[model samples]
Target chain A: METSVLKSKLQSYRELALKGINHYVPKSEPRKHLYDLVMDYPSRGGKGFRPGLCISTCKAWGGNEETAINSATALELFHNAFLVHDDIEDGSEFRRNKPTMHEYNNIGIAINVGDAMNVLSIKPLMMNINILGPELTWQIFSEIEHMVRQSVEGQAMELGWRKENSKCLTEDDYLRMILKKTCWYTTIHPIRIGAIIGSKGKVNPDMFNRFGFFMGTAFQIQDDVLNLIADEKAYGKEIGGDILEGKRTLMLIDLIQKLKGSNKSKLINYLANCRNENQLDNASWVLDKMHEHGCIEYARKVSKHMAGAALKEFYTCFQNVEDSEDKDMIEALIMHMISRDY
Target chain B: METSVLKSKLQSYRELALKGINHYVPKSEPRKHLYDLVMDYPSRGGKGFRPGLCISTCKAWGGNEETAINSATALELFHNAFLVHDDIEDGSEFRRNKPTMHEYNNIGIAINVGDAMNVLSIKPLMMNINILGPELTWQIFSEIEHMVRQSVEGQAMELGWRKENSKCLTEDDYLRMILKKTCWYTTIHPIRIGAIIGSKGKVNPDMFNRFGFFMGTAFQIQDDVLNLIADEKAYGKEIGGDILEGKRTLMLIDLIQKLKGSNKSKLINYLANCRNENQLDNASWVLDKMHEHGCIEYARKVSKHMAGAALKEFYTCFQNVEDSEDKDMIEALIMHMISRDY
Candidate 1:
């Protein structure tokens, strides 16, 4: 499949998912302020990749887009809610090249908005009851339960690691964290939920686990790389923001291993200090060290390897299904996400 | 139905609900810190009023405690989650005589813990599939949907009121806010959900609404009065915390009415200022004025009237149902809550 064609397909699905999300524009007069804050990030428009993937997976599994739209919108809403909280926790200033929710509003209001969005997200899943019946809706609900639990657990690990300044961290530890944090919510659950819904509970959800793990990990590493090197305008986020936040990205873990003596101690001190205070100097210093040590290239290579493994897994999982545009797009997404500079 | 007997019944139900909640003490290693923070409030032991009401209501409708335990535990967990967020938003220092979650942990971490607890709370509700089966479980889920939506809407209203400084507020406004915020989650949904489960989804949930509204409102008014007048040791929370937060309590509204000219302006100035900055001196001055202007007495009268209405509503709702220990205790709890000094 051509990259341009795949991009167009992805855009169409994104538009469809956006339409589904517009169903919940939140018009309650009393709490309109909180609801307005919730629509902020979703309206700013990221890749819409989460919902796009969810809808595509459902289509590829022979389900209509309408059947998947509610779940897809839910995926996007939940992701944005997580991002709103994540921005506050990381003390990041920008999301999608705009002020983070807490930066635009106060932290208290931002938290309230995120909480409301979370509760609203549940509405769509429950709506599945009318469309999918009780048993299937219950299964999807349980899957969502696991997905939320895993994502929060992953977030806690990352936050705990930074708070404790855990120096014993390894590349494997970073991978494990992202697998729970990024992989499950980002790729695994979306595919699993979509597959189950599309197949009308016929598909074995566990079968998609390995493929989602590899694909989502690849996407995350590429994202980390883009944070360091991509133009801020193209990336739609602050360049090198992860280093400033002391996020345990693979590049950071690799750089830590390559550094010796004073460089190592300097990096350690920066991580130990308050991220908001040290962001600028820390980002520049870390970026320089990563470039000098070839850690960025190292992470890129690892990401490509993961993408390759994902391609292989994709063939195994989709082998039984008929060829379709949605299937092709899913394959294209894995490649595009891994290889894109922005 | 004597006061002591009612107290004993409430205590036993609280113990059962606590045991049920103990089943979900969150042991995930990566996020144990978050889970531990969540358990802190529930373990420190507030009255256990929410879950006790839920369990007893279930029993009164002829349901076994085992059938209600999961939902009861979920109610407690969800309530604690709200407390964690509410404390941060209100900037209170104490809950159940211990530091608030944000006071013990950073605001960022406390927010995450609350979010985690909110997610963890859903697992038990999902567990209802095995115990209650899908049809009844879906009904319960629908009830929770209303419960969470109402609670957040109520929170948004209260927060918006403080933010906008709505000086033309009436006692009717206070009632509307508390009805949404306190009454629904505290009384209405619990009885609705309990009756539905106990009657195997046969009861009309609407039947419990009026009864719950009056009972919960009476309970809330008594709680507000206790905050003003109860001894610190007996209250188990920071006395005058609500005044310090400039909460639009009935007594506060009454105090504003009783004051004249400069005193009214002075109080308005205090309410409009940042609460955290004004908490100490404002609490002292407001307490004095409440005493001087008979504001406390006025509030007590209103609360007593509400309690009387609740007692009448209780008989109307429960008269046709079988007379049991649970029913008798529910009747006694109304008088006990309103009449207690501490």
Candidate 2:
């Protein structure tokens, strides 16, 4: 019952996302070039997780769905905005198994489109001034600006680290980088913003932030593990893509520690050299060795452990909810995240 | 007495133009590299007519000098931001007849610098929270973003026109281009923002806006004239540079009308085939023909006419000032602009 409910809500949000983006462009434009740029990839149906969570959070805080929709649209726009630029910066030709924006169109126009989306993202909030005060408007903008600035800084720092073939970074450093680059923008920001608008600052919003950080981290680790064992056809992205880009995943770190001599050197060579399709066999061979060494499963256990921390908070919040049915639904959703293979 | 007083006030703005740019950059950066970028012949030691007018307009609106200074700094940075990108778009090797940013550094780093400067332009405004409200802050951002979008559109339009060799554009069309690319960002927006910040809904600011618009249009016309006759040595920029690039200035428009038959073909060849010493000679020959056709002097007269219209508005405002000394100073400044050759 919970699974069916989540699916319908996800579909509704997806349609709203399309409507939100389409409404921004002027009818006078000779052709709908910008909208066409966004909807070009049809296969990439989103899970709508960040936005769905945002909606749920807004409801959790007792904010009106209509009021929160503007914030949700902003989140969706920002999410795609980063995807556009990130694809270019990383020089990834494909996203969701289709050519990236810069690849499909030229780089110059892609850059323009990314910028336009970023601009359009804020237009929603700016237009909704009847509900916003001067302090709150500045508050939201300052938060977004810091998020974007830190994300860019994190990307630069990670690229610097990657250049050194840095597989030896401590877990603390890894957590800091991912939290800055992935979790903060992806989860906590959207959830907390939704909660704030819902409660209009009523609830203890700090707990939402704390739980979101761990859940997002757990989700990221799941993604990192999926890069190895996940079916290529189902994943809709290149297999071992992170290792191809020389990203220092937890599995890679563990594998490095377990191997030595020529085995280690060969693994490093495969990790560093993603271009040689002939060496892809060796890369896969290394992946198998990591599984055999218990490195991959060990990383998955860690992810589950982090997800457990998030579930603890969810149950605490659920116990205090006046509506038992909503509390039950929230717990079921949390359990699914921890248990689901996907 | 008023006319003389305005001259010194205008000069005062110029004398310290570089000081703020210097102060903002940390001393830890190689002094030579920093100096080389800012102190380049094209960028340095200018009249800063745009920023000067902005500062003066702010003062006239009863705003303090401190509030105006940061706004003026933002204006200068904004100007350089355009220059950074425009040089790349136009692809000429020089700016102010010296090497362009990309030529001095490289395209990648030059682009990064331009991006950094754009981001930095807003930091000063963040310091203005106490004086202005969120409504005003958002308005200013919208204005800047609007200007930038139009400028890029104008650039794309110009590129299309040049590529297709479209000669259908008129004097009105040229005005629209400059209005977007120059007048809006440089003058109109600054004036409106200053008024908005000062008045803060205190009073109707329509008169100040009209005053600024008229002055901005006049300032733009004067610049077009200077592009033709100013000494390259004194201006630190190329004379007839726009002509070489086939920019449809007012003089170029009149020249097209005046030079019938063979001179028209000669002008087109000189402009379209803009390369090498001999081609430059062809351009010079066309300029000589424009002089023979009296187009040069005709453009100068038109500029003076525009300047006169601006002066009329400026003078009316001057007469209304409560203090006679302020009246004198502003009138003096307007006269200085009218009389100056460069």
Candidate 3:
């Protein structure tokens, strides 16, 4: 359960998944604009959380690493694809310590690259048929179908909220949004898919839902917190980006609910301004208000509670499975969610 | 097939596919920005060439109407998704006589809606499980996977060409680009899928590839010609928009190849300018040159040749199959391709 051990385990799984991802990305023509850009975000080191969860859960459930590699690679590709489009949608400037795809290239090229990544991801899933048989492969496809639908629906909610600049969001709304947006693909489906592959589709995937929801939400909260507090170098994203984009993180929602009258109106007006405009002064003011109102501290406390629930659910979900290093890694992952710096 | 009869048959097929597409689009919350937008391009009353080809081929191969609906619907959804993103990428102002999605909504919302449409398309494919069983459904998924990959690669080629403003493009290059971009999804896979379903996977889908390529390229060439000459109201798109976008159509390439000295430099400069800039005089001048240099007539001649080849291919590909209305309709559709104004 030591931090170094978990980090190494995650690193190893990431390398394996990256290898699979690289193999799938066609190194043919149109290299400069298309295939090369498809490799950009994936090559920029992510924590590999999705792939780690999928491969580790599969290993923990008595499947060999090979059986899950294609699925794991597909998950990584999908994750990177989402990040590429998400960066464009959020108007993000930095990713993994580099200019975002849309910033480095033009928006059109970036969008097409994201689309190519989506198309490339399908190859790995199709490869799953040879290893997992048609029935299980089809099940994985269905799981992917649900994962994509939920993620988009969740994205629609958040994008809609920002467009409307809704100031009346609540904790429950935040939870539901993250569950659909962050949890389903990031945690729930990865775990369910890994387990399904590992257990040959015998294990009930529904059993992992609550565990993934709690774990994934906690991870997302911590990520939001890290965006505000972590070193810009370590975080690999611009600090206060969520604020600039007016993302309705739990802390922002809590701050909205707590503030009143003039201060609240000022915050609302600040958010209403175009993201392209200069809003540094207003952004810093909002951050200062968040600190003064204990929004950051409140979010951290809620994240810890979610992590605790994840731990409990993790035990129930994996109680019948035999213990192994992968299981230990997964447990360590849950514990590490609340403690990591980035 | 009489012109009116062909029109009615195409309309009926389009209606059937639209019904299937509507049944798949969820009527849930987040309707305005997400699900509603997902239906926007589909409901814009496209020609339904893809669905019609797919359904008719299926019926011609002795398959029932019910068996082909899901695949046809999925193809239409994919087509619409492509249009939504294509409008954004091309910076197009109008689509089907209305503002492009990105023009009506912001680019961010437009991109997300396109992503949602891509996600929604998967449902119908997955629904194929009970009806077609697992193996054939997997085959269809593989077809879709190839279709999408080819389409994106083709798009990347076109986008890259515009980005570089390359003037030395050849007829072969144009053919290669549209083969991947237009033929694969627009014609090849649809017919292949239909034949596969109709014959219960016994037919060779590859046999339709040349037929599709010839038919689809001819169809695209005529479309380009119509973009310049079709009645504004009947065409449902801005006349000369392709010139504004600096699209590397056959006529444009022909014009480039034929022009000399100052006129060539002038055309290159005109193309190098931003699409947002006013290029009315330059566009008209280029169109005038295309006429004087016989570029438009050259393209029309090429289209007729391709259409002739497609007709020959149609006979060869369908030689073994029994005579039916669907088969005759397909022949009429090919004949209609190089003839229609819209």
Per-model DockQ: 0.64, 0.13, 0.81
- Give lDDT tens digits, candidate 3, residues B1-342: 997898888888888889998999988877987998888888889788999999999999999989999999999999999999998998888888889998988888889898888888889998988899877888899899999989999999999999989889999999999998899999999999999999999998999999999999999999999999899778888999999999999999999999999999999999999485999999999999999999999999999999999999999999988999999999999989999988
lDDT for each residue of candidate 2 in B1-342, tens digit (9 for 90 to 100): 654455567667644444555555434422233323533432454566656666666666676666666656666766775676566545556666577776776443343344334444555555555556555556666766665555544554454455445555676876666665566676666666655555453434456555555555566666766767787676555777766767677677777767768878877666566633346677677678778888778766765675676678776754554564434554555555546666
Show the lowest summed lDDT stretch of 10 residues, model 1 chain B. Answer: B25-34
How would you encode candidate 1's per-residue C-alpha lDDT over B204-237 as one tens digit per residue? 9898888888888888888898998898877877
Candidate 2, superposed: residue stretches over 4 Å from native: A1-4, A28-45, A96-98, A132-138, A159-170, A221-302, A316-319, A323-342, B1-53, B69-127, B133-174, B200-319, B322-342
- Tens-digit lDDT track for model 1 on A109-169? 6777788888888888988888988778878888888898888888888888887777778
lDDT string for model 2 (A59-107, tens) is: 6656666766666777777777667766755556667767787776654
Ranking by lDDT: 3, 1, 2
Alpha-carbon shift of residue A321 in model 3 (angstroms): 2.3
Candidate 1 docking classification: medium
TM-score of chain B of 2: 0.84
Off by over 4 Å in 3: none
